[model samples]
Target chain A: EPEVTQTPSHQVTQMGQEVILRCVPISNHLYFYWYRQILGQKVEFLVSFYNNEISEKSEIFDDQFSVERPDGSNFTLKIRSTKLEDSAMYFCASTSYRAGNSPLHFGNGTRLTVT
Target chain B: LAKTTQPISMDSYEGQEVNITCSHNNIATNDYITWYQQFPSQGPRFIIQGYKTKVTNEVASLFIPADRKSSTLSLPRVSLSDTAVYYCLVGDDNTNAGKSTFGDGTTLTVKP
Candidate 1:
């Protein structure tokens, strides 16, 4: 089965530094999403992208955060100034509208560690 | 979408059936109940999804009450590898509703 692919399985960056997490969604998928989970916490929705534009976003996706689909296949989430609390496991998901119903396929995840 | 209530943790033995129930008293008409499993250091994986009645798949079965206020996830003859955090999410299946929020998941430990 085709799967979502995320680069940099693990990243350690200093606070206030800019970081960009990349994901290559399934070729035919149309929707993209980003979520994060702090240690011992529930997974939180960050943003959703469709039609090459942001369709929805949560409070966590503030001015410091941004998402872009620079290429047809590449989706990215960039944090301009990371804070210590920004440390978490970030996941990328993509979904297809084909067949009967759509199911989101998720990547292994990018573990962002801010020091 | 509606918030859900579930036990924080559960313990089961290998080869035993594991059932995790989630209560959502305020489920909306457009909402669908979905269950996901997450192992440590990995992304969550979809287990089962249902709007009503009983939906069964190779990995698990989902039972939804007629009232649609609650749902149960049943795993038949689970193994140690089934140990993971299980999340019950209430959301719309609409193509545009992609960012479904996850509640505090129930941690299941399947021991040998």
Candidate 2:
């Protein structure tokens, strides 16, 4: 079974630094999404991407956060300035179909740790 | 999107059946109930999804009542390795619908 893959399984950064998390979605999937989970907290939606553009985003996806599909297979989440609260497990997901019958497939998350 | 209410934790002995129930009092007409399992340090894995009645796969079972306001995830004869956090999410599955949010999952521990 093909699965979503994320790079830099663990990252450590200082506050105020920029961080880019990378994800390679399933080759044939069309929709992409990014979600984060603070330690001991619920997983929160960050942004959803489709057709090289952002389809939907949450309040947490503010001015400092952006997502780009730089290439056919690469979807990246960039945080302009990392805050301590930004430290969490970031997960990438993709799906061939959008909703109803098919559920999004998730990748093993990238643990982001900011000081 | 509907807010789901599931247990905070559950424990069962190896080889025992475990049922985790989730309540979504305000589930939408088009909303579906989906369950995911997450091991520590990894992302949540889709276990099963269902709309009504019962649906079963090789790993688990999902039972949704007629009202669609609640669902139950049943893990039969669980083993120690089955220990993980289980999240029940209610939403439409498409980008056109909305982004899905996972609530604080129920941590399930299967002991020997």
Candidate 3:
């Protein structure tokens, strides 16, 4: 089975610094999503991207955050200025069909630590 | 999206069958129930999904009654490795928004 892959399993950055998380979703998937889970908290949806544009985003995905599918294979999430509260495990997921109809394939996740 | 309510935690011994039930009293006609399992420090993995009746996969089985007000995830002969947090989600197929609201999942502790 194909799997989504995330780069830099763990990342550490200073507060107010810019950080980018990269992901490569399954080749055949058409929909992609980003979620974050703070320590001991429920997974929170950040944004969903399709057809090279954002379909939807949550309140947490504010002006400081952006997503780009730079190429056919790489999906990237950029935080303009990292905050201490931004520390969490960021997950990238994709599916061939819409989320409710098809199961999402997720990467191991990238743990971001903001100091 | 329909809200789901499930247990916070459960415990079972190795080699035992375990069932985690979730309640969604206000499920919509177009909603489908889905389950995902998450191991510590890892992303959540899909377990099974069902609209009605019983749906079985290699990993688990999902049983949804005619009313669709509730569902159960049955894992046969669970082992220590089966320990993980299981999430139940209800969503409609027509929604373009890809967000699936994940509530606090039921943590299953498989004891040896």
Alpha-carbon TM-score of each model against the true structure: 0.94, 0.95, 0.98
Per residue, candidate 1 scores C-alpha lDDT tens digits across A1-115 of 8889999999999999999999999999888999998988888889988897888889889999999999889999999999999999999998875211355678999999999
lDDT of 1 by residue, B45-80 (tens): 988889899999999999999999999999999999
Winning model by DockQ:
3
Q: What is the TM-score of chain B alone in each candidate?
A: 0.94, 0.94, 0.97
What TM value does model 1 have?
A: 0.94
CA lDDT scores, all candidates in order: 0.88, 0.88, 0.93
| lDDT (Cα, tens digit) per residue for candidate 3, span B71-102 | 99999999999999999988888864358889
Error of 2 at B46 (Å): 0.3
Superposed by TM-score, candidate 2 places the C-alpha of residue B49 at a distance from the truth, in angstroms, of 0.6
Ranking by TM-score: 3, 2, 1
> lDDT tens string, model 2, B14-54?
99999999999998887888899999889889899988999
**In model 3, where do residues sit more than 4 Å from their true spots?**
none
Off by over 4 Å in 1: A97-102, B94-96
Candidate 2 chain A worst ten-residue window by lDDT: A95-104
Number of the predicted model whose lDDT against the real structure is largest: 3
| Candidate 3 local lDDT, residue A42 | 97
lDDT of 1 at A84: 99
